[model samples]
Target: MTLAVPPTVPDPSVRSAIERLRQEFPELGPAPIVLVVRTCREELRGSPDGALPELVERLARQRLRVSLD
Candidate 1:
């Protein structure tokens, strides 16, 4: 009998986004915090100061709460 192996998972873009956020907002916790970038282009284009508030609100609406630790 042959053993089956599980497929590899792709690295989530959210992780990098969260890391950048942590660097930009040191008061926030580490990159393990969940983050969803609604608009990738907008996030990459805009300043972190402007982008973070929107990202936080969007995630909150989805009931994915985040906090600075």
Candidate 2:
């Protein structure tokens, strides 16, 4: 008999970070928000789990804000 494995779900903080960035930079719209979040997450992929959410949020915010300037 074989058992099935479930797909890995991303942490909620990732979504939260994305949404917060979207709200903070509405002018950039959904596509840019998603891009920034994904980029930030990738940059911190090796980071400690406990710190990822806040790190992702901060990095994404900075990147998006810089884009606006």
Candidate 3:
């Protein structure tokens, strides 16, 4: 599951992730799928500015099947 971006900066990559999941789980049908994105304050260790986009880009760099189509 991919994290939903903040209102100010939407992430287009999420749609690819959703499409990936759908292909893997065709039985899902039209039911709603929800996966909340969360990172504990401690885990962040006071992340730098623009952390969300940074993290998202870093994740994309890993070549996660989030999109290789």
Best by lDDT: 2
Q: Can you rank all candidates by lDDT, best first?
A: 2, 1, 3
Q: Distance from true position, residue 66, model 1, in Å? A: 12
Whole-model lDDT per candidate: 0.41, 0.76, 0.37
Model 1 lDDT, residue 47, Cα: 43
How would you encode candidate 2's per-residue C-alpha lDDT over 1-69 as one tens digit per residue?
122232167666678998887887888889877777877777787999899999989988987788889
CA lDDT for candidate 1 = 0.41
Candidate 1, residue 23: CA error in Å? Answer: 0.3
lDDT of 3 at 65: 37
For model 2, the run of ten residues with the poorest summed lDDT:
1-10
Off by over 4 Å in 2: 1-8
Q: Judging by TM-score against the true structure, name the best candidate.
A: 2
- Misplaced by over 4 Å in model 3 are 1-10, 34-69
- What overall lDDT, based on C-alpha atoms, would model 2 receive against the true structure? 0.76
TM per prediction: 0.30, 0.81, 0.32
